[model samples]
Target chain A: MPKIVDHDQRRSEIVEAFLSVVARKGLPAATSRAIAAELGVGTGALWHYFDGFDAVTAAAYKRVTERTNERIAGASTGLRGLAAVDAMMHEILPLAKETLDEAQVVVGFWGRLAANETLSAAEADVSDMWGGRLRDHLHEAVDDGDLASGTPVDGIVDLLLSISVGQQVHAVMATPLLDPARQLALIEQCLSPWRRTPRQPGETVTR
Target chain B: MPKIVDHDQRRSEIVEAFLSVVARKGLPAATSRAIAAELGVGTGALWHYFDGFDAVTAAAYKRVTERTNERIAGASTGLRGLAAVDAMMHEILPLAKETLDEAQVVVGFWGRLAANETLSAAEADVSDMWGGRLRDHLHEAVDDGDLASGTPVDGIVDLLLSISVGQQVHAVMATPLLDPARQLALIEQCLSPWRRTPRQPGETVTR
Candidate 1:
């Protein structure tokens, strides 16, 4: 029998390559030719996976979001209650080099997505999806009595999403004077006001 | 003698042209060529006014920041106490079609500004410049007993900037359901938590 490859897996591989290319180069420079060159494949082969630039760009973003969700989900094992929520919130910001790189690429895509009507809808949907997930986590924490009473669930959700986006924006805009470690410290400090109990201060962890 | 163009005047005109082009197109689409076309001038004329694309982009952002500060300054009149502070907060968000258009361009510029080093420096300088002014205004309000005592100045500043950016992001990403009046209502609602006194039943204005 002839060897059979998973088409979806191959498409994901192409999208991963596309994200790497976007991370190194700005989105505008991540053209089909550039992505193809980075993947070490002919442009025609990339097209077999993606119909056009829009499809490829959308796929790249979807891959990033999916991988990010997976990271958070995978970290929840053997931990429950507030510990899971804390871990998820910590993972929300880009702590690792790989996650930071992903964040940089995601921020780059936001600019393109904002202006392009075709992508704008998708971007809004993705944002709301993330917001919904964060809200669910907050609600669970509230039910578990790990979060403060009278704490607005949706507001916390918005705060988490906004702060995460704000931190990435700060990372890309600010000088390396404050790298990921310093930033995570600032964020954790800001979040102290809303926490049910004080978190012992510590340096950032790469998981 | 024939009319002589001053350097400051010409620079302002060039920045205006850049903003208009960016407002119509987007940050990425606002090339020197497109800005010149929007200005009804040649690329050579634009170069004569500014050094290059980076210079123009920086200048354009500076001009917008100046305009926004001046407008906020004007809103400070005819009000006392927290009323004045709330008035200024209202103006920061886009209250009119003109400001709304400018904000769209400003929000789009943020992502590109994050990705580009030169532009990122310019943006940080602008943030510091504006944040400092805000800090000063807040300090004055505190001294005048218009704001609550013991409020963290920097926290207020961050909150203001965050909400400002958050509202713009919402406007850009979500459908414009909140009219200007309704948007003002939401602002008042957000401000309620910090106000020193409770409003009379159905009272729209603070005494």
Candidate 2:
């Protein structure tokens, strides 16, 4: 019998290594060679668990998205309506070093996705997942009277999704107004109009 | 002279070739060899004009920015305040065939920019340029009473910039609500609050 090799586990390790490279040295520096070295293997070794660099990137993209989903789940536990919505967005936004690394990795994958057809972008899934989450939380907010009864939920949902995608690239671009305070301010800017009460000073949960 | 070689003209042609490749195919296909082939030249010839593909990309990036600047200038020639702001945003947003192409090119360059330090992303120049233009027109809107007198102009400017950047990636991602009508609706969403009058029917330009 051949030595048992956990392909799934090996793939997961490769994905984790790719992410480690991105986190330590930004997206551009997270090339295949770097990922291989990070794993203490040769460049060709990555191919054993993955088809190619694109496949590795695709896996890393999925990993990041899943990680984000898990984080949102953890952060929004026991929260509802506006509270849940805010917590989820906080987890997604690059408000801290960890989330910022996630943003960089996501943006890099998006770049490659635009150029490569073989890799899956899962664009619809991402949009739908977030859109659904936002809709549920937003409608709950309205039900709780935290948001106005006549709030344009659908349009607001689209706007928030756009902002989420935009901020991901903006993170790598190092665009100004990228600080934690300002990132939350954007969420405030979106929600303020419908808020039954305007956000008070010191109300923002700055990370 | 041993032979006449218009270095400036050749570099321009190379930049144009890169852009044409991006427009004709897409960002991923616009590799150095393809760009050279587009110009009916060997791959080796591109090096005479550019340090590397990175330089070609940087030049292409500059070319696109200048072109956008020109379009914005042309579009807002006789407008001011919110009207001017709307006109410029129309040019910047990926609302139509031409502008959408630009958004793709810009987004692709941004991806490369995140990875390469030598390429000159010109992040500040882009932000400051649009920031100043938006500030000027927004303040004009405030002065002209098109916007509320106490409107938060700076925050509004930052918000607009974020939307602009967001919409670029949103274009590539083909995120829902990318249609011209919805794109314009976002602008309307931003301005509606400050508008003394709500957006009347047919107020938005669909394309």
Candidate 3:
């Protein structure tokens, strides 16, 4: 009988090797030979699973995005308004060592995006999906009377996304300032304006 | 007289060449040969001013940081409190094509920081400088009654720094959701809390 080959498993192994290579060494050193060596295989073996280095990168990126989406979706289920947003934000932050490595890989990919249109497109798609989900939660918040009727959902989503990306960079860089508690506090402050009751005329909010 | 070269000016030129090479071809192609070719000089000339490719990169990074600090200081001079913070943030953002290149170079440097301790230390120093400046301004805001008492200055500074770095990544990537106007508006919202007057008891301020 012929041996069974699980193509999906092999592809996943190749992508795992690609990410490990990228995480341990910056993307510049993540050559096909290096990735294959990481997996204890010959360089030619990578080509069997991926069209080329670019294919491998794209696949690895897809895997990262899928994992992120899965985590966010799982965390935010049955949640709405500020609570849902908080859950999603917490899920995306680099609080764990493994997630920190993921953040580093994501940062590595940012440098390549300027020169690689395909990778850039993939990243943009993931970004949009993330932003769209947040926007949906914001809309739900407003509809549920958790946010003001005229709350700028679009702007809030943009702010949250910007803060999230920025926090990822700081966390990966190990900046002394942004510990997990501080990070969570910052997110709360960004959301605070939307959480307040609709103001009466001439009432001051900030002291 | 033998040809006299101003060492400082020559160093600047080499650093410029390094940055140009990085901006045009990403960090992977920023070898001594590529930088020398960019400057219309032999690779040996780069060795004359810098010890090696690492030294050249370090010098280039120093130049970038100096340029950034100068710009922020110049822009924020005579401004105070939240105004000062706003000016500094605006100065740091990638508002022009040149700044956009700086952002790309910055993202490139971030990837290298993980593997290069010298570069990483240099980056941490710059981040501290930037954060310190922002913190000083936040302190001023509190002292001047521009913000509420117990306004969490440290957290605010961390958030601002994170948001600024994050926005730089977004702007460089040309994320459609965050244009210049939107970016500025988001910053304004982050500042809005401090801009408002303190709320009286039992008063809603969101109107």
Interface RMSD of each: 4.4, 1.9, 2.9
Report how large a share of the reference interface contacts model 2 reproduces. 0.45
TM-score of chain A of 2: 0.92
TM-score of 2: 0.93
Q: How well is candidate 3 docked (DockQ)?
A: 0.33
lDDT of 1 by residue, A159-181 (tens): 55555655555545553312655
**Residue A198 local lDDT, model 3:** 45
Per-residue lDDT tens digits for candidate 3, residues A4-45, read 357878899988887777667755567788988888888998
Total colliding residue pairs, candidate 2: 0
How does candidate 1 score on lDDT?
Answer: 0.62
lDDT tens digits, residues B57-159, model 1?
A: 6777677778777877687666654565566666667666656665566555665664465566566454455556667766776777655676456655554
User: Taking the true A–B contacts (Cα pairs closer than 8 Å), what share appears in each candidate?
Assistant: 0.19, 0.45, 0.40
Which candidate's TM-score is highest? Answer: 2
Write model 3 residue lDDT over B1-207, tens digit each, in one string: 133457777888888987887667665567778878888999898777787765665666577778887888787778888778877777777776667667766765664554354566655466688888889988898899878777767766777777778876786567864477777777666766665474354542221
User: Relative to the unseen true structure, what is the C-alpha lDDT of residue A144 in candidate 2, on a scale of 0 to 100?
Assistant: 95
Query: TM-score for every candidate vs. truth?
Result: 0.75, 0.93, 0.81
Candidate with the larger TM-score of 1 and 2 = 2
What C-alpha RMSD does candidate 3 show over the true interface residues after superposing them? Answer: 2.9
